[model samples]
Target: MAARVPGPRPDEERSPLAVVLDVLGADEQRRTRIAWLYYVEGLTQAEIAELLGISRVKVVRDLQICRQTGLVQIQINGRLAPCVALERVLVQRYGLTQAVVVPSPHDPAHLPATLGVAVGAWLSEKIGPGQTLGIGWGRTLHWSVRALRRREIPDLTVVSLLGGIGRGSEINMYETASRVAETLGAQCYYLAAPAYASSASLRDMLLEQAGLREVLERARRADIAVVSVGSLGPESTNRRIGLLDEEELPGLEAAGAVGDLLCTFLDAAGHPVDHPLNRRAVGLPVEDLRRVPTSVLASGGPEKVPIVKAALIGGYVNTLITDERTAEALAAG
Candidate 1:
């Protein structure tokens, strides 16, 4: 199949340079040959010119045409060809609209930052003027804020999908929401309560409050939602940050919990686990995430693969961004 080159529409206004580039890119056969020699064979322009009996200037021009026409595509291939092949399989298997698989970092600890940069660049391009973005919090999301490119999007709104944690951290839901809003110069809304209420009644009462209710409604109606999955293991951010009690871990495991999205623990099947924590949790329901036009789930690591698959099974996320190792694991399963 021919790679589709995304750009301005034919009917849309174009600059002089764009027109000239389009004209230069019209010769498909010549551009393909040049791209093959330069990219696949690793030939320099002068060498390609000599071999093809063409001028060095034409070789350079044809190479430029290759890029402009999408005759040659560049991407990070972790295992040479597996990443691209796995991306297609994932998209088809899970019914996802899109899947991005980045090369895994050498150190396991760097996975969050690696996925963060990718998600940040995605958000920078995905969001536009007058759009509402609903976001969840985690270590990966916190790192994402560091890589977010500032944009002056008019009338953009950011809604925090979960309540804030008392313990201060870069991954705090309120902190992530506020930082993203600040970066995009957008209006911000927060769920003004703890991530987990003392009891189910208190969570219900907090959700009934006018301000908090408004924010939750905005989150549900957001144009885009971005979230990270959390493992139920001891090393999970919830455990590390003290949001979850150590004693509760055993009970959660007994209940068949795999991981969580927005602090709501889910089983391997993507259904909310039958546990007290689910009732006390304060955030958008996983089911409600499906209502959003586009929901992006970004996470990685061996422990998270099962939950990531569950989230897909539950239809909570339409887009997935993960590392190559995690992608391979998910595919194998």
Candidate 2:
């Protein structure tokens, strides 16, 4: 099937450069190849038109778009072809609106930091005024907060999607929301309750609280949600922050749980698994996330590749930012 493209309409307001570049920078492989061919391979529009079996007019338009959008830029080392190619593959494969893949470091331990900085840069480009951003917590997200460039957004609100993870680490739910809110010079709504209540009944009672209820409501209604996926390995943030017993891992694994988002466990297929802990969990449901306008998931590391793929298939994330290593792994699978 032919791929969709991203750009503004002819009548819409855009700089001449942006319009030209949009043509050249379109996600469709043919258009990209056309830009590459015309600029890099030194092919004329007519030659390219004959080569791709497309109309000469299309080649002209594509070239014009490339120029308008600044797709043609002089660089010291040239473009990062691998990351760009992988991003295109991911967008096509997962039906993502956008994909940002950063250079992967040799060590797996640093993937989150690398992915976080890239995600931060990507977010700065997409974020606008008056956006209510619902945020999830994890190591990668923590670094994202650090890397994010502070900006003022009028009436912007940042809501914590999960309940508090007090004093655990910099990546705690409280820390993530507060940091983003502070950076954006926006208001914040925190889920004051703990990540897991003492019991299902207690969870229900906590949910009934006016403060917690209000925040969760805002979270569900958020314009965008930024979250991370968690695998059920020894390095699992859910397992560590939940203070779960080692024995419980087997039960969750037995239940076919591969990973979790907002403390909602999921099977390999990304369906919410019927685990007993789910009843006591506090946060926005995955179904609720689907309702949000955009769900941005930033995660990487070899351990998370499978869960990330599951998240993609489950329709949990419309946009993804991760490291090239994980991106390549996802593409291969």
Q: Residue 328 of model 1: what lDDT?
A: 92
lDDT of 2 by residue, 1-333 (tens): 999997878888878987777775545556678989988899998999999888999998877665434444322334489999999999999899888887888877777777777767677777788889999988888877756667788898999999875556767889889988998899999899888887999999999999988998999899989999889888887667664557778888898988887788888788988877788889998889988888999999888987899888888889999888889998997
Deviation (Å) of 101 in candidate 2: 1.0
- Whole-model alpha-carbon lDDT for candidate 1: 0.88
lDDT for residue 298 in candidate 2, whole number 0-100: 93
Clash numbers, per candidate: 0, 10
How close is each model in CA RMSD to the real structure? 13.3, 16.4
Kindly give the stretch of ten consecutive residues in candidate 1 with the minimal lDDT sum: 68-77
Over 4 Å off, model 1: 1-80
- Best-fitting candidate, scored by lDDT: 1
